[model samples]
Target: MALYGKLETEVEIKASAEKFHEILHQKLHHISNASSDKIKSCELHEGEWGKVGSILYFTYVHDGKVSVAKDLIEAVDEENNSFTWKVLEGDILEHYKSFRIRVKSIPKDEGSVIHFTLEYEKLHEGIPDSHSLLQLCADISKDIEAYLMGNNNEGSFIAKA
Candidate 1:
């Protein structure tokens, strides 16, 4: 028996959805260049980049601590510009029995709305809810949004709650 939860967040950015989606599909490992303050690096550990079931190893600075995760690319939808990754090993597993992250972007006339979704199952009844983790993700999405929009030095792009 498993208990699950899902969280979704979206932010508007002045970047092409198609281009950003393509970068995710083909060059996810390059994220450190654009967002070095958060992500230290990402590498393909198994299988090929942009391929379903491929494994990715990520080293990221989360809340001032370095955390590592090995994740599997679970799904990819090119037309919708979305992909999902299932966590294999990481700090997230310390509290969650299972975890996944999904990302996508929808185009708008003025800009694009980038979306990020998280799905997870608690390790046990005493483990507590995931509100903080979800909030962290939403914040990171805004950072990524700001970076991609060429607003690197501006704090104006932070999504308003």
Candidate 2:
């Protein structure tokens, strides 16, 4: 039987929900600058940015090693400030049969709560679950928030599983 799993994490951002959500959809490319430690670059590979079905290419560092991914913007829920990304090609595909990520930014009185979900099906039983990836997402969330708040935290925060 194939092994399937879901990993989730929540990060609190000290920025407004609407602003944070807008950055996620409108200024995705800037995310690399926001979380330089985790992501080396994020570029538009195909289609228009901020639109459904748009493709984004990412080069990132995870578990102290550099990796790359091609992700499809599968869905965008503006009303709820949610986005879904489907991984088409990448190092992650080497171990997982399929991988998908969903992120939702919920409004809060002070700021926003960023919720991340990673869903994957392992190619084999030997592949461990993606706890490191989930932690990277959480760290990146805080980095982006700091960037939006005019605080550049370059190299100050390190990600670990």
Candidate 3:
């Protein structure tokens, strides 16, 4: 059996770690301009928002295609301003066994680090590396930062009222 590895990417945001974390944890419908379509329709499946063990379900569109994913809140640390999620089920499972996102604050700065990790099962020998997924995560991070910083004027992915 092939042991799929995890891929991660991090970026610093221009908003306070608390603000960013809060926005990230809030109900998915609240975000007016998310970068990824998958994230735009996200909603808590059970329990309160940001609570560990809560499940979030959402439909995601990638490459003009749409699919669904159910993810569990793996961890949440308010003190460190970090949270993590693991995929419980999803359309992407054919190629991936699990995926996670972690966000942590940087001390002495109004910024935080957003990290994304994915563990995939090789579907074929031709399966390419997860660089595109990582880039997608980076784009999502940037969109979140822009939304929190009040710069998403055009209204792309985040929901608008």
Measured by lDDT, the strongest candidate is 2
Preferred candidate (lDDT higher): 1 or 2: 2
lDDT ranking, high to low: 2, 1, 3
Question: Of the candidates shown, which would achieve the greatest TM-score relative to the real structure?
Answer: 2
Rank all candidate structures by their TM-score, best first, as comma-separated numbers.
2, 1, 3
Cα shift from native, residue 90, model 1 (Å):
1.1
Task: Write one digit per residue (lDDT tens) for candidate 2, span 1-161.
Answer: 55999999899998877777777776788788888789998899999888999999999999999999999999999999999999999999999999999999999999899999999999999999999999999998888888777786453122211
Model 1 lDDT per residue over 1-161, tens place: 44787877777777667767766677788667667777789999999999998999989877679889999999999999999989999998998999988988898997788888888999887776666666666665665666666676644232332
Clash pairs for candidate 3? 31-159, 32-158, 32-159, 33-158, 34-157, 34-158, 38-60
Tell how far residue 44 is off in model 2, in angstroms.
0.7
**Cα-based RMSD of the predictions, in order?**
5.2, 5.4, 4.2
Can you write out model 3's per-residue Cα lDDT over 1-161, one digit (the tens) per residue? 35466676777777666666677775455653455454557787798788888898877665557777798888888887777877788776676655565556544455666656665565555656667767766777787777766676664333332
TM-score of every model? 0.84, 0.91, 0.78
